[model samples]
Target: MIGVLVTFAQTGKFDRSTLAKIAGELRGPFEGMAGLRFKSFMLDEEGGQARNFYAWDDEEKARSFFTAELVEKVTGIYGAPPTIEYLDIVGFVDNSGT
Candidate 1:
């Protein structure tokens, strides 16, 4: 598995409501996306940051998804560029079925 962390440092550029609306609007497209295990949208209003954590079944798909065009589009939507980080997912625990 692979983990992609996308962070947007708002610095007062965007508000919580706007970010939440963006997340709500965008969630539908990712619902059954291929090669995506899960995607989480997070925000820290006090810290002035919004983050998205994506878990992918493979690195290739994850890498391919975050292209320049996608970044540009997201930047336009969020009103700021993001700092993207790819990480090796060593382990995880899923208790959803419990």
Candidate 2:
């Protein structure tokens, strides 16, 4: 599996409610996305960072999502370019069902 970590700095622009709203808005684009296994939306309120962890079926689709247009959009939202990291998903565990 391919794992992607997309991190953006979120300062005063997005409060908790607004962040939740943005997350909700993104759900539509993520839904029914081919090769997307799962996505985790994260917030580091203290550090002022918004993060997204995406597990994909392959590298191609993972890279495909980070297009030029997407970079521009994210930059506009965050007021800067995002820090993106792509890694191989070597291991994992799921306890959400419990």
lDDT (C-alpha, whole model) for all candidates: 0.92, 0.84
Worst 10 residues of 1 by lDDT: 10-19
Once fitted onto the true fold, the runs of candidate 1 whose alpha carbons sit more than 4 angstroms away are none
Model 2 over residues 9-97: C-alpha lDDT tens digits? 85554457766877887788888889999988777788787888999999999999999999999788666578999999999888989
User: Per-residue lDDT for 1-98 in model 1, tens only?
Assistant: 99999999965855778878998999999999999999998887777888999999999999999999999999998888999999999999999999
**CA lDDT of 31 in candidate 1?**
97
Local error of candidate 2 at 82, Å? Answer: 0.7
Give the TM-score of each candidate.
Answer: 0.93, 0.86
Q: After superposition, how far is residue 13 of candidate 2 from its true place, in Å?
A: 7.3
CA lDDT of 42 in candidate 2?
79
lDDT score at residue 91, model 2, on the 0-100 scale: 92
